[model samples]
Target: MRLSNLIPSIPANVVACLEVQGIRTDTDLLFSTTTFDIYKRLPAGTATLEELTEYTTIAAEIGAAPGMSGHELLLLENTYGDVQLRTGNAELDGLLRGLDGRWIIELSGDKGSGKSTVALNLLINHLASNLEDTALWIDTTCDFSPERATQFLDATQTLPSTLERLQVSLAFDIDTIQGILETLSRPNDPRARPRFLVIDTITPLLGPLLSAVSAQGHAIMTDFMRQLQTFAQASGTAVFVINNSSRKGRDTPERKPALGPSFALLTDTTLWLEAKNDNNTEDSTEDNTVHTMQILKSRSAPIGGCCTFRIHGNVICPT
Candidate 1:
């Protein structure tokens, strides 16, 4: 459980800082501290978000930490006030407790699995519910539609004002995505920061790079994830990243999410959405398609928890 042995590639400065703080082993980090606690112990301005994230990732991988007890976790939640952005779906909300601002939420699915629809619903819901709060939507796939946003708000009659608060940015490449994230990291006005951030299908934007040259792609993705972690932590902004799923063969047990373990490990929650066949029953007549969302991995909730829902009009509701 030595920190150096567990993550050999850990930055030298981070290792030195950990040693100086007497945190030579994984248990030293786990028993009496949180990642932030460790970060505070590091030399001022020497620890980067990426380094701390890598440390925690190794901790999880090596099972050095058993996680916080219920009491401690509950105390933390109480301090944070349990504030979250609602998904506009009651059942989904009940399962997820809403999109939490303290962690990243990753949604992975194949094309036509209602990922974008759900993201848009959350954006519209947040803008409608909180008039002063705004949202930033980074569309990499060019699938975001203003018309759909307007349609979602038509029922609530808050389209005009909600649209004003919803900021849209198109990032066609990795550089653009990185630049946008950087801009968010250093907001001109703290009050103008968005309540939540969305990147629809981050895989599509980074997939080609990984396919062409994996090492360079992984480096870029790692930096992107680090920037995202920093931005979310600093701003307390709820981040929702949509990803594509790798197709599975008939013999494969299940489909896997793209971007490999590094990206997967970066997220706090990973939800996999798969389209279900039409049952053709009385309830089935209400919607065109039903989606089964599996809680593949979660740090706060029980893993393997799942729910079924359908997209009716523009809103996602449990079936």
Candidate 2:
């Protein structure tokens, strides 16, 4: 909290000037008075009003959450790495090297590929493991089904009260989802904070923004994605965003994530889901289909790790 901690950001002379005014810590710089007042109190030309404003902004950010050193970050990973959140399927969890901590995991696939099924499975498994833990599901397509979630919860033997911890919000626009993220990023009771957040098909919310005539939409999309990363890091919550796939290029049958290349870099990992066969084969039951979830991108784990599973009676089962 020492004013020197913001060195290089707040110039040495500026820090000295502020220190002369008894504004030593970030809290003092922020709470002593408005940024303009601080500028007025400073010796003429010691620092510009614009410069003073920028310094205070940086101070506020540091106060909210300071940067993590490399060693500290390594320790954090080691601590949370052992407690990966299950995808509700053992094989799938092992295949992806286990998901943990504050990172974005994207699920992208075509319609009928069972993206929602996988998301619900993950949410139920997380909520069932602990009674006090909470999760948020932002439904963008109005396709989130409580009946399907009920099936998953039942399979996990999640207590009836666990359902209370899984809160779902219908968000069809970027603003609504952004507001939700901002709200979650604020300080709250540790037990009340959500440990996992799912945006069921982010495609609906971001697709138009990326396809607009003006280039401003792209900027908006970038800002929103960064906001997501900030929220994840601030709260140590694992974010899962679902996306729909599109053809890799205009003249190709191969498919890729729909949000384009920028979005790919924004997420920590991307999982592509494909349904090999959805129809009931002669050997299969009425409600069963073999699906493969493949890792498209990862920082720590190797890419292209594909795991197979099936939806039997709405429950995801490892093959």
Candidate 3:
């Protein structure tokens, strides 16, 4: 079943792939056995990957020598690298950033909270990091504004040319957004890795759509969210969603409500952004901002902290 001899020109990642997939021996069955699942299960553990180069080199050589199909040659090259994946965000840098693969980051708070601004800030960060990177902004309420793009960078007091590079597919509904994400998540497509994805709010995907179609609409929204999760997981891109805080009971304490149970279950991190009580507009003057932060949940680290931020000119600046 060994393909290494036949694909002697392969890279180590390929050779190691074949060997680990039980393809180390010569046989017709090797082709059948070395399927998608076999390659998917290939361990990318540090120690195991260290020796991939030597083996992949041998296999790739054979693939290159002559009669291999382009598709077959592609597989050899595609599967043969030590890919250092990136999250394309500064706040969630290092291992915690893109590790979750299909991470859902939710920003939830009452009205006037800077949740949307913070999400936009990340969107800018994604663009600043890579000009080629794309971002999707799903505007359920028609609130997405290019004019407001400068607001997220307000602290800088100046807008840069790169800000215009924040590519977006403005989706007015859940289904529209769902369709766009599906196209972006297809494997082997260069457009799959957008810099950031923003769901302005999940309510439009749930309530409004559900009311019109009843239970069926609710089910469709649910499926759409699942698809979002799948897209995030496979592409290793960031998923950001703004959520409206649930209403509090009349007699209930002003304490904030936990986000939807399902949100906590699916997102890698959940952050709450709420402004402090405005004692006076001019009195606080710590750059005239008073946004507070709390890590509602974090799988990568201790989900805890407080951060003060404000929109100086148009952007959210950490104070």
Q: Which candidate should be chosen as best, given TM-score against the real structure?
A: 2
- Give the per-residue lDDT of model 3 (tens digit) for 118-180: 677666765665566666777777787776776545544444776666665666665567557
Q: Which candidate leads the pack in lDDT?
A: 2
**C-alpha TM-score for every candidate:** 0.69, 0.74, 0.61
| lDDT (C-alpha) at residue 157 in model 3 | 46
Model 1 per-residue lDDT tens digits across residues 93-171:
7778634665788989888777888878877887677777778999887888887777777755665776888888988
Q: Rate the local accuracy (lDDT) of all candidates.
A: 0.73, 0.78, 0.57
Q: Higher-TM-score candidate among 2 and 3?
A: 2
User: Alpha-carbon error at 9 in model 3, in Å?
Assistant: 39
Least well predicted 10-residue stretch by lDDT in candidate 1: 74-83
Q: Candidate 1, which segments miss by more than 4 Å at Cα? A: 1-83, 157-159, 211-214, 249-253, 279-287
Query: Model 1 residue 179 lDDT?
Result: 62
After superposition, the stretches of candidate 2 with alpha carbons farther than 4 Å from their true spots are 1-83, 188-191, 211-213, 278-280, 284-286
- Spell out the clash pairs found in candidate 1: none
- Candidate 1 vs 2: which has more TM-score: 2
Q: List the residue pairs that clash in candidate 2.
A: none
